[model samples]
Structure formats: structure tokens, C-alpha cells
Target chain A: MTGSVLAGFPATTIRWRDQLDTPAVVVDLDIVERNLRRGAEFAASASVDFRPHIKTHKIPALARAQLELGACGITAQKVSEAEIMADAGLDDILISFNILGRTKLQRLRALAERVRLRTVADNATVIDGLSSAFSGTPDRLGVLVELDGALKRCGVPTVEHAMDHARKVDRAAGLRFDGFMIYPAPDHWQDALTFLAACKDAALQAGLDPRVLSTGGSPDMVKFAPDANVTEYRAGSYIYNDRALVSMGGASVSDCALTVHATVVSTPTPTRAIIDAGSKSLSSDLFGLSGFGMVRNRSDADIFALSEEHGHIEFADGAPAVGDHIAIIPNHACVVSNLTDHVQFVRGDYWVGEQRVEARGTVQ
Target chain B: MTGSVLAGFPATTIRWRDQLDTPAVVVDLDIVERNLRRGAEFAASASVDFRPHIKTHKIPALARAQLELGACGITAQKVSEAEIMADAGLDDILISFNILGRTKLQRLRALAERVRLRTVADNATVIDGLSSAFSGTPDRLGVLVELDGALKRCGVPTVEHAMDHARKVDRAAGLRFDGFMIYPAPDHWQDALTFLAACKDAALQAGLDPRVLSTGGSPDMVKFAPDANVTEYRAGSYIYNDRALVSMGGASVSDCALTVHATVVSTPTPTRAIIDAGSKSLSSDLFGLSGFGMVRNRSDADIFALSEEHGHIEFADGAPAVGDHIAIIPNHACVVSNLTDHVQFVRGDYWVGEQRVEARGTVQ
Candidate 1:
């Protein structure tokens, strides 16, 4: 049986890959550093503070490498995640999520005391909760007014509503209206830039200091122009491209650093084979794509379906035999980090070691 | 804010529920016990060995409860998962997936010494590995020949092939051909029973004992007839029903014991709101269903889309307001267990403390 699409890696890496336990997540540090350097260079050219979201890797070491590569700060989606990063010595973090509830607010308050922390608020309820917990604190929490740009998931629907929330944030106790943020949708750059400009103009007219205009979505990071209105870009999936990112026009498969290593456990039919990887290993996030993931270097084969412990593969010819190890590039890279407890890191000819996903399930 | 769909519970449970952090998985002990008893009673009536799959909860406590409630053994989907259960003192485990690779086979050998461990193998390659690892041991490893009856996954395709594999297991050293296993598809019980009967007759004619004729898949277990040929039934998702189960006619919404606790984080528009629970929390298993999950007690709202940390809700008349707490029965409950580190167990008036998911990502 052929080794893998990564069969071209160093013989040491190749042999090491073959020896790994099946259904393993392998992250190539060589590719990771290359992707990080590219993102840092792009951010430098665009004059935006690059805050690489740690949701992709969830490893403190990778977060530190992102910072060392020129990110001003990092972006965490949950307070629990930000707390983990803070415990690992990451000082500056922008939790690009709405912080709510009393117990979580107190913990968020504690987290803010330990780091240069910031968060987003799209409604008065969240702002009120943050105010109640942090009103008497010495350091006011930085708040970013999230706008309902093209994504339209969690943000104020209109600029008027956004300005209203911005003003409310400005007047709220123990909270400073630091900036604007949006997890903008890809393929709508013109409308997104327009929305950001209008929000910035409205903030200026209201005599508010809108210091940061952050826009993010990894696919559009490639289109960031020199004169783009946003001051920061948060790209989570850029560091490890997946089929979603590649199909979304962000990066090619060659740039993807992470892959799920699996073994062919069965060939049920002449044209179909089964791999040990499934929804638990390669997550079941389909980006309107045809299959769950792509087998490395096998355009003739694609993973068709995934049960809890088995991945069904349909091939044109030469179905892989049982016991042949294969590597799969999952549809989404961010959630893959959450599915596994640890990820193996490999350099050119040596095993860098395994890193536990520090925030694997830090949903809260 | 209205408390939750669980508002009908005692004031203590409601108060305790309100105190929980958002995006938490709350498992009702009352409902869990009820579901366990129902599954056990059904299996008893069918005269089959009830081996509840721990892949649903991944908690040793739940597995113990299932065993105490009449489950002869427990079903673990992977060898790593079985190892965790064994470490937790589960005396008998059936890893219903194929066991392959050197490292995993070695661990399986060690686990067999600790517990009565049985596993399924569909091909000669897997049987060869198991035989090599267990040869010369005092206790031969139990092997179940799997037939691809309906759920065309991890099983041999034809009865002839299954007989061949069964004979191979009988002849293989240090391995006992214990039974035949099939994860049959629902709504096709007649064909499934025919296939099972054919395989059983073939084993008898070949002068081998297929002691345990196992047919599983929770959906079809509901239709277990009095004359069902199977000796054991392995049901994984019967413990915690989800939207997929309820919609598939295997369960009802009231039978679902687990719900994701989330707070309305934003009302972006009159018809749409966003909740703190997203794919990271609720998971993204659609199972041909329209939405991600159902908002408890609110027919007016359903979650339509999910981002990494945002759930988009589309509502009709009374859209949920910001800060309102709601519970969501996920599309699939098993995957939800795998997504979180701990699950909050609650009874009528008591808030059972959270239990860590012992093997949340035991997909080796």
C-alpha cells in the first residue's frame, strides 16, 4: 500500500507518520509557520493589527507563535478560551463574542484583570450585564460594537441601532466603547467596507472614539486592500486551511497544515472503501461541498459519508486495501481541533511532539 | 426572562438551572433513568442481551447505571473508548467497530485481560491482526463477524463473505467466533431479519457456534418483534433522544433528556435572534432535518444556522428577547456529549454537579 499524499515528506516523517496511531490529527509546523508568516505579511501591508484567532489550533504554543509572528493580540471566541490563554501567559486577547450572565461576568472580570481584555456587545442586555459586574473595577473593560454586516448572525442590524449601542457602551459604567467589530461574510467586500465606513462616520459624528474597526472572515483576507477601512483583521482558518477554506477561495490545499491520518479498515465494494476516521475525528461540517473531506493526492477518491466511527470513501479505481494509511484534509479545520484532545506536531524530519488542545471544549 | 422549558421543574432545579453558565449541556437524571428503564424493559421483552452503547454519554456513571438497569454489557465504538470504560471498572465491553493496527491491537490485548472484551471484524485483515495479538494467551479474544445487512458500514457485504470471515475467525488462533453483528438500517426490518437468518443458518451448517446474533441501530429496535432472531441489541442514542431521533420516529421530544442551555445574545432583527450556542456547543449533525435543533417549548422559533459561536434563530410571532434563557435539543445528542468536557446532571429538585465526559474524544 502507498504511504500517503504526504508520502513526499522526509523519510523520517514518512516513517513516523506510518507508525502513528490511526485516526490521528497531524499538524505540520513547517506549513504552519509558512501560513503564519503569510498572514503577518498581509496584515503589515494592510496596516491592520493582525489578531489571529486561536479557535483554529487551541494550542498556546501556536498562539504564541502567532504573536511572535507580529500579531498585536489574539482573538478568542469564548471567555473560557480566553481564560485558558491567559493562564498560558497570553496577555492581550479580544474575546470577539458577547459576554453574558452573572457568574460568567465575574469570571470575565477576573480574566480582564489578568490581561488586556476586550469583548463585543451588540445589545444593551449584554452591556448591562458587563456594567453590573465591572462598574466598580479600576480598569474599564474595552467593548467593541458589533455590526450586522453580511454575516448577519450576531450584531446590530442597522447602523442606527449600532450607534445607539455604541453610545450606550460609551456611557455605561466600567466600560469603554473601544471600537467596531464584524465577522463579515465572504464575497461581499464592497457592502462590508461600505457598512464599516458608515458606522465609523456615525461614531465620529457622535463624538465617540471608535479606535478599532475590525473585520474578519478568512476567505476575504486575501482581498484586504491597502485602503481598507478596517484597522484589524481576524483570520482563524488561515493558519490551517481546510476544504472549506480552499473552496472558499482563501488558500490552496498545499497551504493546509493539518490533516487527519487514518487507515483503510474495509473495502466493502469494488469502488468503495472505509477509513477509520469519522465525524468524531474529521468533524461533520460541510460547507455546501460534495463530501466530508478530500483524500490527499487522490483526486479519484473523496470521502462520501461519515458515521460515528467510519468514513465511507468512493473511488473511481484502485480502491485502497485494508491496512493502508491515508491522510484526509477535513472540510473545516477550526472544529477539528475541538474534536481531538491532542494534535501531533511534525517538522521536516523530526516529531516536534504532541500538544494538548488546551481549550478543546471551552464553549462557555 | 422565563426560566426554561424546564420551568415545570421544582423551584430549586429552576434556580440551579438559571445559575448554570450558558452553552452548557444539562442532562436530566429523571429523564435519563426513565429512558434507561424503557430501553431495558423493551430489550427484556425481546429476550435479547441489552448492551447499551456508551458512545452516547461517554460517562462511566451512565454506563454503570445502564448495566445496573439490566444491560448485560456496554458497547464502546472504539478501543480507546473501551479502555476508558474498563479503567472506570466496567467488567464487560463490546467494541462494535473493527479493531486494526499494531498499537491498538496491543492495547486491546491488555484490555482483554482486564475485562471480557469483544470486538467486530468484517475482513480477514482485521481478524489476522487480532489473532496475532491474542495468540498464546490463556483467554481467547471474542470476535463477532459483522455482516453488512442494511447499514452498509463496517461489515462484509454478502452472507457468503460473512461465512468465510466466520470460519476464518473460528480457525484463527486465540480467537473465539462468538457471534454475528449487524447495524441494520431502520424501516427495512424484513430484509434485515432475512439477512440475519441467512447468516445464522450458514454458521450452523459450517459447524460453528454464532452464539450472539446481534442487530442494532436504535431506530429499528423500536420494531423488535416477539420472534426476532437477534440475541443482543446495541442501542447508543436511546439514552438521550434528539431532534433526529424524534423526527425519525424512534423517540419523542419529551423522551429527550439532554438539552443545551443557551441565552439569547442578540436580537439582530424582529424576526431573527442569535444565541450563544453554536456548532461548538449544539454540534452540526442535521440528519436530513431542516434546522440545527428545536428551541424548547417554543414552536414559534427554530435555529436555522450556526457559526462557530453563534446560533441564528428565525422566529414567527414572539421572537425570544435578549437575556432570555432557552434550552435546545440538539439534532444528535451523542455528538453533543463529545463536544463538551462536562455535562450538568439534574434531577427534579436537585442540581447534580457536573460530571466530566471521561472520554469526550476517545477516537483513536
Candidate 2:
């Protein structure tokens, strides 16, 4: 018989079957709500405005749920994502990134008309552009001076640089200087705090009130929060702890909210098992992870290699038999969500069935 | 402003108005046709049957084009993929993977009732499973022994081991031993040739005529084709060359057909620019790539880092200004295709516009 006839495997089963589907995305919603409330409660307990970032969870539904629970507002990076949230009535949004170009600025203006929109700037050029577009316009835009600590990704490296941008923002018309923003490097808490303190002193010297000081990375959340100086805690992925975070000892496997359902397609030997979920589904985004991800309940197994559509699981112990389904908690949850159009949310066992990753693949 | 919000900044326009309504798996039809022809022609010139593997490009329309161009049939990894092709009325399929478990065997039995199917077996247990399932069946199963040349992925390591499996298949009821199958390791042409020679001797020793000696792998296709010993050639990625293939000097940037359409969202620094295509859109699958992908036309720029929702492009010469649209050829095209439901196909000047990745996220 030809292979074509034998290969009529099912995608409908993934969409409809109670179980036995290969390469499926699963999320634990109960853990997600708990993760949301934890961050919001932490913000309330710390006595600061809790503007939860929606970038981690792009689903507008999740963003709405967070706002309903106690989030001050939602945060977005792209005008597209922000627009989606705003369209869904997430009116108070901080673009959180520099808004540039006439096209984006016009979109931002439209968004500002419906919401209290703010963006971050590390230099005077961006501030000038913001001022040039919005000056004498009815819509007001809030600008935050980005102070970089050790993370060389973005922002001004020092308090002096941050203050210079802050002064320029204060002088620029239609641009409101709202305070400071900093994305700390891994395990550099003391340095981030020191930079924040310096920014506070520089802002006071510049005669501008620094209202908000935000810091959050799911890994460093516990260490940075409860500080009298830090204003808000913005942590996502705690809602869906992945292998990377689990490896860092940030969260337990039981707390993880997302997992990939994959079937063992080939058990070539006693050591290597080829899985249906490869770089495409489970994702090859390893954040210093030893493997692609960890198979839940199978600690000894390692996802050593990945082809485009196949994951090669190497086990020093024993390989999984062909047709056996393995649940993989990815190294990162957000990327996984973005790859799938929808993810199935199940309450108990895998056979318990599906729900939509309603926000899956919402890159725009 | 929260860090999550700051990170959510979309570098490009999120025009919901321009959104494609129905979810579809998009193909750059022009490139796909070119890739298919190139592969088919390559096989024809080499005097080998072009059994273009349908695993990479799963769409039936593409397969039809390949078959019309003189492809012997198609090689499928999953039963579902084969089933789709079968529904499209194309027969002659070789399922490249080992078939296991009773549920899968039952499915195979049903598939055999429809079309010509050949399957590979690396061990005796799998051969037994196949024989037991099709004992009284009229449709004989063509069985090939998977040989491990150098990739060490699947297959038996030695010729003796492969012959052992082949013997089992020959002894099994309603099963016919075809020949041998080898997936060569990258840059290991000499080792592959040596193994193939050994396989030839082993097949003759086992008193079986090696009519169809199959050797596949895109990277080493040229190395194997010139030898004329291999009867069948299976190559998939040559249709859509990715960043990793380009890096290997196997294909040129022009030959690389697929690209991710992205916009510059955050210009945090003069050197660092953030794009709207993050790991979700761009994917974190590097395949030994230095970064995520190549920003088409920007030779000096390197996508050095990627977060779940952010792609960090470090420009050695100059950064892209915010709002600039950039095209990125990902490290792995197949995985990237699996990530998105559709991709816009643009001709020389974007005149061709966008198309849906119709079977994009079919993991089941």
C-alpha cells in the first residue's frame, strides 16, 4: 500500500478528541488566575499602582481578567498589541516602548484619544519626535526616562544620562515627564536599586517628580518586590512557569500552567525517541536550558535535539515507546502561546479535553 | 509604566483592518513552485526517482504540482499527512517513519485498503506489529530497513543490523522487503557512501535483490546523487531554504523563498532595534545560527537576541528607524511555517501581496 493512504492522521482529533492527539498546546487556567492575583496582591501589599504588562499574556481576555481582578492598567510594546487591548477597552495602556515615525505616532495619537497612553524614551531625539507630533494637539503623551542598569539592551546607562533626557522631556511641549523605567539584568538587584536611587536624586535636582519606579522579570520578582523604593511589580510567566524558570528554582513543576502534548512517532532504539513536537511547537527557545524542555513526570529524559517538525528526546535511562504521548512544559510559555492559534485548557488529565489559547498567535 | 508594557510595544502597525479573516496555511506560491521544480529536476538529472518528501510541504496543491512535474510519489512521516494526500487522490506513498502500536497498525490497515503504501522498519518488533496487522491483507507492504550512516538519529548502525531487520520483514506475512533507506549526516558523504556499499553487500548476502536503494538529506544530496548507486532521492528543505541552510552555503539568499514580515517597534538605542516579530513570530529556533535570522538586505545587521515577544537586531552599521518594515529569513523555514497560520507572499515589489499558510499549524 502507498504511504499516502496510511498517513491520514488527524488534526480534527487535536481539535475534538478527548485525548490521543499529537503535538497539542495545553494551559492550566486555574494556575494562570492564581499567578495574576499573586502579582496584583503583591502590588497592593507593596503600596503601589499595579500596571500589569500584557505582553507576557497577549490574550485580551487574560488582560481583561487581570484588570477585573485589580490590575491598574495593561502594558503593551507594539501599537498593534496595544490597539488590540485598547479596542477590547483596555483604555489605560503604557506603550512602554519608544513610539517613532509619523505612521506609528498617528496610531498612538488615535490610541491616546481612547486611553491614557505613555511611552519610554532614553534619548532626546525620540522625545523631540514625540513633541513634534503632539505639540498643541489635544492628546497628551506621558514620557518615562529609561535608566539602564547592567542590562545593555536599551535605555540610558547612568542617572546623568536619564536626567538629561528627563530635562529634555520637561522642556518639550505635549510631552509629560512621568518618571523613570529600568529593566534590570539577571541577579543585579542591588545595582538596579542603586540606579533607581540615583535617578530619584537626579529627578529632584532637575525639578521633576519621578512618580513610578517599576521592575519585574519573573525570575527576579521575589527579590525586587516589597522594597519601599520600588513602586510596582510586573511579572508574567509566573502564571506559566517553564523549564527555564524551573531550572533557576523559581517555581515548582506543579505550578507550571503550560505543556505541549506530543506523541512518540519513532522509538528507533532504547535510548532515542523521536517526538512530534519539535522546534515549531515546543519551541527551540532555550534560555540556558540544557534541553528543549522537560517531560512532566519524566525528569531523567532530555530533549537533546530538535529538527523542524521532530523533537529527538535522548534518555540515559530508557526511551519512550512509539505512540506514547509525553507532556512537555516548554522553556518559555509566551513564545509557545504566540506560535499556536489556540491552546487547549484542561482541568485534570489530558483526556479531560480542550479550551482555546484564544490569544495564541496574536502577534499583531 | 511596567516593564512588561514597555516590552509590549509593537514596532509596526497593527492594522486589524488589514487582517486576513480565515485562518490558512500560506505559501509563497512562486517560491514553492520553483523549489518543487528545482528538486524534481535535480532528481531527474541524477536518474533517480524523485520521491519528494511531503513532510515539509504538507499542502496537497504543492504535492500535486510536484507529482505533475514527474515525482514518483511522496514520502510522509505521519499517517495524517499521508491521509490528506490520499484524500487529494495521489497514491504511491512511503511513510518514512517506523510504524508502532496497535492503534497505528489499525490505521495503517485502513490506509492500505485505499492506496499503495510502503513503510520503514528499524527493528523486529515493529515488523511483527506490521505482519500481525496485515496477515490476511492482499496489499503487500514494502518494507525498507533504515540504516544509520552518520546522523545517528534513527536506523541501525551496521549493515548486519539492517539486514537482520530486513530478513524479519521478508519473513513476515503480507510484507515484502524492498531495499534500504539512509538519511545521511551533514558533510559526511564519505561515511554515507561507505555505509551504502556495506548495505549493498549485506542485502546480497541476505539473498534479496536491492532494487530501490534510497538515500536522502538535502545538505548531502549533491554528494550522493553523483554516485548513481541510490535509486531514490528524498529532499524537502531545498524547496524553502532557511537561515541555517544559507549559513551552510547550501543555498543563496535569493534561493531562500520564505521570510517573516516585521516592523521596527523599539529603537532603544542607535545600535539596537526591536522588531514586532519575536520568538512567537520569528521563532527562537536557531539551528546553530548565530542569531535568530537574517534581516533581508541588511548585511551588517545581526539578530543577536530574542525574547518570547521581542527580536533584538544589533546593527553593526546603522539601526533601522522605527516604523521601517524588515524581512527576516528564519534559521529554519519548516518550523517557522508551523508557527504561523499564514504568511504573505510578495513578488518582486510586494505586488503579489499575502497568502494564507493554509495547513500551517497542523500538529495533530
Candidate 3:
């Protein structure tokens, strides 16, 4: 249970296909390396520092690869995931979520000791928590004032709130007001930049030395420009583009590095076929995709329904037979990465090795 | 990592909260035991052979509890789950899925040697795989022909297909055609029973002995009558009934045993609060519920949106503050059970112990 399952996998017809069971996750190193290189190129062309959010693929190897490809650091949502990446020898990290609670903050404080740690504080509670955790520490932790963007999930709602939070973080004993973080930069990147610029101007006028303005949206990352004023970008799903990315013109279908290789278990109706991947395997994160997932090489099939262990595919043109292997590009690659313990690695169609989903099921 | 995370859990004013990290899964043992006892009592009154599906909990202790409460056996959806239960000393287990592929079949054969292994077959491919795996064995393995119900995910489509598959299973070497299986026995379970009876009539007319008809739907299982002709009832979600069940009037909120304890990390807006639990903790499965989950105690807060690590809860009246602890009963419990390695066990508000989710990520 602790190690990679290298043996007892079902055999595949492809000469070097790893015998991973159905609903097996496979990450093609070819596409991954290419995607990483392209991301670096995009960042260099845009004059923005690249720091991938490790929440996409928690594999330590991928984080190392990103650093080797000129990534400044990595972003994680949890202290536990950051701890894993830290243990893997990535020195710089930014936990993008609001780090709250005593246990998490205590762990965050310890993590700060080992790495160049930075985190975001959208509200006063988070700032206060950080202040308590690091008040007496030798090195103050860096805090980014998270500004609300298109996603509307987290962050300060307005420049007024942002200014207040930034000032609060700066006044905190154990924190440094380092930068700004605008998440899901959206297609309207210019609008976000305008807001960020307003926030930055306020910070500068208030005599605050804001070091970076980190912004990210996988679809908008490539559209970023030098005058965008964002010094750093964090993209989680860019490396393993999924169906959502392809549809949004973020990446091509072939650019998808991770795919679920599922076997058709039942052809219940003439138009309906059941695959082995379901919500448990391929997550139920539709993320605006019309279906559960997009089947590779089967444009006619629609993965219409999903249960715990079955994905129903309805097709008119391509009749699937039971035991037929199919590849699926999930809607969101990040959620899929968190499902399996380890993903089978492949180069093209040939099985190479396995990369463990190193930080999977890390609750904290 | 194999053992329970018993250290460094944040202290709570509530004694013995098990200190599981936020986005922690805590199942109430009192409710679980009551649920188990009620399920046994239902089986006795309904006059059906009880086989609680371990797919819901996938905890060996829960399976043993079910057996201790008079369950003739336990039902699992995957061979690997059955293998895990077998390792836990559960002898009679029915894997109620089409077990296909070479490795799965070989493992199924190995599992049959240790337990009274049973499975279902909806197609010729699955039947052939079973025959190939079990052929030359001393004893025949039990197989129930799956009849497609309202779920339309899997199962033989028609009575003829069910009879044909059942006869094929009977003819195959080292295979015994035990009964029928209809999934999602709907509100109109009589219709599914009608279909099962038709398939049974065909088998009986062909001089075949169909001993049991396994019908299961968490909601409809209670509506089942003694005259259902179904000798076996396999209810998966009855143990930890979720929001879906509560919404469907299958069970009340108090009947739900599993609840996610998450802390409010951000109150970004007056009406919106963000919790640490998200798609990674409470799965993105919206089984007809409007939002991600229903918040416990706070009836006003609507968990409307969920990202990978943040659940955005919007409330008009709650005015939730940051650092507030909220328990959410997810829309679906089975998917949540798979997202965690182990769950905290409690009697009520006080955490007592932990139970390892023994068969999580079992691909086969």
C-alpha cells in the first residue's frame, strides 16, 4: 500500500502499455515536458515569473521538473501538500489559500522555517492568525493580499478592502506585506489588471513595498503580456490541459498530458455503453463541459451519466463493444490528479513507469 | 501513513474531537450502529437475505458490523474491495459488478478460493471472462445476471438478454447462475420486480433454479415488501445516508452518519463564507441536489459552489464568521468516503476513534 503497484496490472495489447487496471490514470511524459517547456516559454515571453500551483498534479517529480524548467517556486492549497513538496527539496513555496486555524498555522510556521514561504490573506482573521503563528519567529512570513477576480471564490472584494487588508498584514508582527494574488484572471485579464493596478497604486501611495502581483487563469496565461503589470503567474491546470482547457482554447486535445484509460464494461443499450471510470475515478467536476468527459478518438460518444464506478457513454455512430479500451480527457485535470494514488506514466502510447500522486488525499 | 493520524490535531473546546484535520470525515458510530441494526431489522421484516453493500463505507469494521447484525454476507462493487473484505475475514461477499479483464478475473479466481465469491454479468464478454477465470476450479463461483433498472448505467437491457446471460453463466465451467440483480430499484420498484420476475420465469422455464433476486436502491429499499420475490436486498448508502437521501425523503438529516467537519477559512462577503472542504473532500457529485452539500445545524447557509479546495457557502441570514466550524453532509456519501484514507469515528459530537477506509483507490 505504501509503494507503487508495479505488478499484477492487467495486460494491454499495446506492446509497452503498463498493465494498470481500468480507470487507470496515465500521464504522458512527452506532453508533460512539452507543456512545461511551453509554459516556461510563455512566462519568459510575457516577462512574468512562472510558479505553477502544485494542486494540479501533486507529484513531487512534476514540481521538481517545473523548478528545473525555471519555475521560481510552486503554489499549494494546503500545508500538507506544501510539506510534501518541501520534503521533495523545492525550497520556495506559496500556499495560495487563506491559512487559518492553530494546527494549520503552526504547521505553516514550521514550513516557513525550511522554505521561502508565502501565503495569501483575504481577510483580517487570516492576517491575525498569521500574526499569532509567526509573531516571535526570527523570520517573518510573506503574506499576499488576495484580490477577488472573476472566480469570486476568495479574495478581497474591492480596492478599499484590499488596501485595508494589506495595511493590516503589514502592521502584523510576524508577516510581511509582499504582494497581491488575483485568481482565475478570466478572459477579461485587462479588467483584473486595472483593478490590480488600482490596488498597487494605493499600496505604493501608502508607502508599502509590494514585490509581486501574481495572477492566473490557464486560458488567459498565454494571453498575458509584459505591460500586464503582473510580475508572477500561477497556473495549476496548464501542465495537464483537460477538456475544459481544450474547449476554452487554452490547449489542444493532444496537449492533454493526463487521461483516464477506461475499459468499456457494458453496452447496455444500442446507444449506451458503460465505462469503468465514474465519479470515483473521473471526478464529477463538469466545470462547464457538456458531458462528464470527452472520449479520445470517439467524437460521437457522449459520456452523459456517471455513478460511483461507471461512466455511461451514449453514441450513435461509434458502437462500443465490452472490453474495448478508451481514453478520456477529463473536464478538469486537477481534480482527477487528486483521485488516484499513483498515475501510470507513458511516452506516446508506450508504458514507461509510474508517478505517484504524492500528495493525494492530503485532507489538510 | 498506514496508521491513524493521532497526533497534532488541533484542540477543540469539544473534548475528544479526534482532532482530525479540517475537511475531516467524521462518522457517528451511534448513528452507524443504529443504521446497521435497522437495516438488519428491515431485512428480517422484509424477509430478504441481507447483504449490505460495502461500497458505501468500504470499512472492514462496518462490514463485520453488518455481519454481526445478522447480514448473511456483504456486497461490494469491485473485486479489489471484495479482496480487501476477504482479507478482513469476511467470507461471503458478492461483487455486484461485471468483473472483466484478465488480471481482475485471475484475482477473482484467487478471491473465490478464500471466500464464497459472487459477481454479476450483464454481457457475454463478462460471462466469458468469468468462465476463463474459474474454469478447472473445484467449486463453481456464483453469478447473478444483472437486469438494467432505472439507473441505466449497467445491466442486461431486456429479459431475453438477462436470461441469455444467466444461461450462459450456468453453462460456463465453474460457474453457478444464482439469481438476478436490478440496480436503482426505483420508486416504481414493482416495475423492476416485474422485469426480474420475467427474467426469473424464463430461467425457471428453462429448468434453471434462480435462488435470489438482489434488488437495491437506498431510498426504495425501505419501500420493499415481503412479496418483492427478491431474496436479497443490498443497500449501499443506508448506513451513511447523505443529503441526496435526505432530500429524496429516504432518510432524515439525523440519520446521516457521515459529515464533513470544515472550518470557515474566509468570509469574503457578508453573504458568502468559504470552507476548507471542496471537491477534494466532499466530491463534486451533485446527485440532483442544488449545491455541493447541505450544511449541518446552519439551515440558512447554502453551499452553492465548490472549487478544488474551497466550498463557497452563501447565506442570506447566517452571516457566518471566519473560523466558524461547519459540518456538511455531502450530496453523496459514497464518493466522499473514497476521497479520504480514513475517517474519524464518533459517538455524537465527541470523536472516539478512527476507521481506515480499507479499500479506497482499488481500481479493479
- lDDT of each candidate versus the true structure: 0.86, 0.72, 0.85
Error of 1 at B180 (Å): 0.7
Q: Which docking category, incorrect, acceptable, medium or high, applies to candidate 1?
A: medium
Predicted structure 2, TM vs. truth: 0.82
As for candidate 3, its clashing pairs are: none
Worst 10 residues of 2 chain A by lDDT: A1-10
Q: Model 3 segments beyond 4 Å from truth?
A: A1-14, A18-20, B1-14, B17-20
Which residue window of length 10 is worst by lDDT in model 2 chain B?
A: B1-10
**True contact recovery of candidate 1:** 0.82
DockQ of the candidate models in sequence: 0.73, 0.30, 0.73
Error of 2 at B185 (Å): 1.3
DockQ of structure 1: 0.73
After TM-score superposition, the amount by which residue A301's alpha carbon in candidate 2 deviates from its true location, in angstroms, is 2.8
User: Which window of 10 residues has the lowest lDDT sum in candidate 1 chain A?
Assistant: A1-10
Candidate 2, residues B1-364, lDDT tens digits: the string is 1112111112233332244221222234456556666676688778888888766655566666677778898888767667778888879888887776666788888888898898888877678888999889977888888887566566788877877887888889989899888878788756776777788777887798777788877766555455646788887788777787777777788888777777675566778887666777667777776878898899998998876556788998889876576778888777766666555544333234443445566555
Candidate 3 per-residue lDDT over residues A178-245, each given as its tens digit: 97988854566777888788888899999997888988878887677885568898898888999999
Model 1 C-alpha lDDT per residue in residues B311-344, reported as the tens digit of each score? 9999887678898888999999999999988988
Q: lDDT winner between 2 and 3, please give it.
A: 3
The segments of candidate 1 whose C-alpha lies over 4 angstroms from its true place after superposition are: A1-14, B1-14
Backbone N/Cα/C clashes per model: 0, 35, 0
